[model samples]
Target chain A: MQGKTGSESWQEVWDKSVNGPRALIDCWQEIPCDPCQEACAQGSIVLSSGICAPPALHAETCNGCGKCVAICPGMAIFLVDRSIGSGLARVTVPYEMRDEIRLGGEAWAVDGEGNYLAEGRITRVSGAGRPGRTMLLTIEVPEEWALKVRGVRGRRKLLEEPEEVEAIEAVEDFAFCRCEEIDYSRLREIITQGEFRSLPALRRFSRAGLGYCQGRFCQSILRSQFLADCPEEDREVESFRVRAPVRPVKLSRLGGEDG
Target chain B: MSLPCEQLDLLVIGAGPAGLCAAYEAAAVGCRVTIVDENDKAGGQLSKQIHRFFGSSHHGAGKRGIEIAEELFGDCLKLGVDVRLSSSVLGLFSNGEVMIDAPTQLCLVNPGAVIVATGASEKSLAFPGWTLPGVMGAGAAQTLINIHRILPGSRVLMVGSGNVGLIVSYQLLQAGAEVVGVVDTAGSISGYQVHAGRVRREGIPVYLGHRLLSARGSTGLEEVLVEAIEDGTVKRFEADVLCLAVGMSPLCDLAAMRDCRMVYEDALGGLVPWHGADMRTSQSPVYIAGDASGVEEASVAMEEGRIAGISAAEDLGSLNSGEAAERRAAIAKRLDELRAGPHSRGKLAAKERLYAR
Candidate 1:
């Protein structure tokens, strides 16, 4: 998770080695998507729990068709062939950034953390597909760093100097309501005062939702904070009362006077 | 203070993709169409989207949104659709009467048919310091970059991993801004993998399961504190601007005023007017399309606009029932294809529930 050598478990799977071409479904979470399975024309990609499950690839059945590589919405699918050559291996990943890496151009392979890993050359660049707006790029990397190199920086490096985390106190003192100019500390102070019991009382005490835009923006914030402070079992969340003239309107304009 | 009212065959509110398409379709069918939008320009949010759209070629899949908007606007103009820019519909009366505030005068319009395509408004998330001057909506940032040709800030922090957040983060990078990272509370990235891949490859770190706790600054945004939900670890990242792409809610104020049955569907972005297959609301002569009916893609909105427009034209006797049915079927088929993805299952169910009655 720290760097982008895919995930640690994926890295271990890649390190264990395999023969020929294989599709790596780097997706771990059970998201409501299964385009990768549908993209596999060979029936190699399978999911157990309908479309909401992550795809499971059958390495033997996957012929490295690269269809799943092009169709994956998460761009989590990758094709790796360690048996390409003695020292050189091929890795196909989706590239959709603005700066396109032309075929045969020098590709700067980077890890998951955007750190430069090794240099590679773009071997192939595929055209855009249907739903997924990504183009496939096959890069030739060293056999050892094939799995570690997850992406290629098409343009410049976005490496930033590591900054030390300063010990900051009272950092949560910020504005909660943009319309009413209410800060978090102020709202917290009001909450701790214990005078306001209901949302309307809170509104009256702090003027959190009395701005021109009404409570359309701040009411949710007030509710969330109230819930966070008070246990749900102890208090029921109350919504702000809505009135006529829901949206802001000029008095003169309401009078039908032409400007 | 009663003003003289103009009569129209069909009145379209908003000039976005939906409203523009609705106006064009109705006007092409010989219905006297008038489109009213609050903005000075006609292309609503479409003008701000510089990225190419996704879907079939019929929906302008390969073309940029700005180009698509231009094409729609050109069609509306060529078909002689009356466009009222910088005109806001102040109130929508039940009797097909709309009170509008134009630049010059306050006027009223009584139309035989009404189509609401007012679109959606950005939903904000509350964190400490979210109200700071530098913090703004991702749509606002996109507008500033693509439309206004201005960068909101040099170092930006995007909250949300949905398509909007991912796309806007990429756009921010394209506009020469340093995206600190994209943070989302969801365990997995909510947006398309292509968009996420694009931003990830650009070296923008995406922190999943991380919720924005607070934004710390005095006069403006200085830094943002995001806490990982799983471990409760807080990390502060340096960011001048905080872009909230949390979500969007349907702008159903006018629709509600018209007494259209509204439902709070979380999948459809909360508080959307109940509309049917032809985009017609419960109220006769009143139709809803686009995000005003429910938050959806621009492609779906365009199709819904065409369907609503054809329905309105048929109601006005400009288009025959046979022609309207054919057009609606074709558009509905295309719409079904667009919503046939796994990600759109929720939206599909939401649409079903909306039209169940």
Candidate 2:
């Protein structure tokens, strides 16, 4: 390994944000793991070899179709938009939940490298899932704010800018689920998209909350986010479809020692 | 519950890193070693670790942990160490009687000493929509990726700032998915700064001091709701996946059930069975090594396993006291070195006290 400039290409990849759309994965590492290849519904990536070859990301083939997203275990990829258009590149990331203040609230946006850059108002809030885990709040910042805010600060004792943290604190609206990438804002979109209005019906079009682990981590959190948004309605799951495989099975279990 | 009545040979349980180490040590000197474990596989957590371990060469460093486990499995087989899997040792009877779940009729094993090496469990977070489909544990994420050769999710929101969380997040990036971001409840990154820095430099953000408030998306997880608090106030962010690396509590139930002397130490990651440098426990005849005693990394666990097994062999009269002492002194020095780095210091201290007893 060379220095930080070790391989100019590695740095270029990061600078260009050529890093994949998931977290913890490097399509660049020349190893072998192809689930990402199989995960892509649109054939955007390839894992041709056995499980040792690193996945190949084909730019033109990528439809921004989140199939690879659902299958990637590392969560290392992201749909980054370095192209600043209209002074702002809205990188529609996969957001899971919110803190409160449904209509539109303030958030201290952070860039991909954990730096605080700008302020923004919540633009859109969507909620879905059988139980409704996150109320995805799409905050609209200046076009430049797009790249500046890649992430949001989470549940630590925020000692910086006390007054601002307090303002958001008093707001109380959503939740975050580190799975399936669905939130209230997203759920609402799925419901309204004529993508099957009801919870179970929505399963066909959007596959809300349907993934490998089968929704164990974000189930309760989403329920509260749903009730928080709906309010006057009954706080029940209210007909959400329960996907199977709550516990992931080992390949050995699947093959049953037959292999 | 340990060795009583006639002094027997080496007694080992759980057959993972710690138990396997003890078995090998006892077998090296031909000390009738008997190993029992609840799982059919004896490698324990080693089978699940897909990545190369971080440490020096002596401790099997640079070798992928799974490979190390495979090697250990092979050694134990060749040594003729008695390993009974799916054989749950029901109790630690007063006179060395251990009830077990075996392939044949009910059985019992009485040995001169024992080694405990049960590992740790994945910690979970409380969040709305957390129970929705698509959500899983960080370990589960790794299991899906490295073992099953599958991707857990394309977009992920990882929680926890521990080494596992950070390292896994990095691995996730390697797997080619969008790491929505990392959400840690602590003010600072809990894992190695180097691990965190690598990913941070890669353009992933770490949301320290944040909590997962709730999550949405009906059939599965579509969004992640997170909030940060300062001066008793909260701020929020939303992301796709919710990976929690909060912390792990040591698995001490089996040891605890035996009524062995146990103590709680924050540095050790929770309560653990009492042991000493040689890996001997308060019960004298029983020895324990690795995370089961407390939550430490893999390197220390393996070294500790070696120490305990050697000591168990000597106790079984297989190895002379001088020989056991010589072997242990060497392994302990290496173990101490592995535990010397900044990351291992506090944990090493807590684990050292187990040996002190």
Give the number of the best model, judged by TM-score: 1
Listed models, DockQ each = 0.17, 0.06
lDDT of 1 by residue, B267-302 (tens): 888777788899988888899999988888898899
lDDT of model number 2: 0.59
lDDT of 2 by residue, A60-173 (tens): 445554544333333334443434345443333333322333445566555556566666655544453413122233445565454344454332223232122333223232
Over 4 Å off, model 2: A1-259, B1-8, B103-106, B127-135, B175-177, B217-220, B231-241, B352-357
Output the lDDT of residue B88, model 1.
81
Evaluate all candidate structures by whole-model CA lDDT and list the values in order.
0.78, 0.59
TM-score of each: 0.75, 0.57
lDDT of 2 by residue, B111-230 (tens): 668777777766555445655666677877776776677877777778887878887887786565668678787899787654575467455778788776666687777766566655
Please list the residue runs of candidate 1 whose C-alpha ends up more than 4 Å from where it truly belongs after superposition: A1-107, A111-117, A120-155, A160-208, A219-259
Error of 2 at A211 (Å): 28
| Top-lDDT candidate index | 1
